[model samples]
Target chain A: MPHATGKITARELIDLQSHLMLESTLVGQFNHFARESTDPQFGQLCQKLAHSRTDCLQRLAQHTNITPIQ
Target chain B: MYQDQVTDKNLCLAVINQLKWSATCLTGKILECEDEQLRQDYMQLLNRTFAEQKEAFDLAHQRGWYQPMMADQQMIGQVQSDTQKLMMEQQQSMSPMHQMAQYQGIQAPQGLNNYQQSFTNPNLQNQSIYVGGGQPYYSR
Candidate 1:
């Protein structure tokens, strides 16, 4: 029911894009941390975090249907 | 040597710190966001990130990577006493202002009192000055 018209302002679109970018960047950082970790458990923890952030990124991207232009 | 010093604990700490900052950034953005839908969406993300950050912190604590310092009883008592002292000082400072306000409520202001007195003043009665006119204008 929220945003029933599905219309987004330029400012909203920019915010969405920035959120997506931050999420993506977090995912990359977690992935890198996973690889850099010496302990297997720590690596798995980073992987889980990365996956969670990815899910969040995907959810926001799908909700707003906006992605930052490369 | 620096690379060698990087351990699992250090890596976990790094991730935890990053998550903490990310949550803070999201909070600020959500506060500033004007759109209703965007605010709601970002609020959800912020909650999730905060939960995940807590999880990371717990894991680190369990593994002895992050040991939060526990406050001693003496320190706790000192803080409580200091806070009470500050409260007492604030109340004391406000007492004079409160008394002044109450006193003012019962008395007319000086300016109003002077203006009221001016109308009843006998010396100023029937006194006026000529303003480039042949006749003097009397004021009562």
Candidate 2:
């Protein structure tokens, strides 16, 4: 069944997935950078961002009520 | 176009799957790092990420969006048998040093079952990773 919460249409869910794809990739890149960086400060900041991606991912998942599938 | 074809459930499931893979990949990378301090930081982050995912899963479940499937007795047995076969094959084909080099600490997370819903529909499986629904643009 296609669910619509008020004005939130199915299109938005697709968009959310697209955004998440970018975000997850970006986080992965950031983590890679954090791992490779020699400077402690830069690495710490990148690591922090990689963590923050989690909260963003969570919000997106909540908004869409994503059906969990591995 | 694709939007019309996409049901709410399909859309939700796609997003959920992507997020699951993302988290797992991040965990794998964290496992690969040798620095203890960095690994600890990532471990903390993974903890937060898992917590948030749980909340989302609960909400999705409540709304009837997320449905987890239990592995049946036969399926479990099949998986065990398959594992044993693979182990034997690995033993026959590879040396211990090669195997150790290849194996990453990338086992599934505790909440792996959360994403293991029995999605048996083939039409659902063939859906592309991206949206826009594989429309024939030239037709227009």
lDDT, model 2: 0.53
lDDT of 1 by residue, B1-140 (tens): 67557788888888888888888878877877776777887888888888888888888988998998999999999999999999999999999998877665556566644555555656675553322222223345
Q: Provide TM-scores for the models.
A: 0.68, 0.34
Once fitted onto the true fold, the runs of candidate 2 whose alpha carbons sit more than 4 angstroms away are: A1-70, B1-8, B71-140
Against the true structure, whose DockQ is highest? 1
A1-70: candidate 2 lDDT, tens digit per residue: 1123223434444544665676677567557656765546445645665677856555444445544443
TM-score on B-chain, cand. 1: 0.65
Q: How many backbone clashes does candidate 1 have?
A: 0
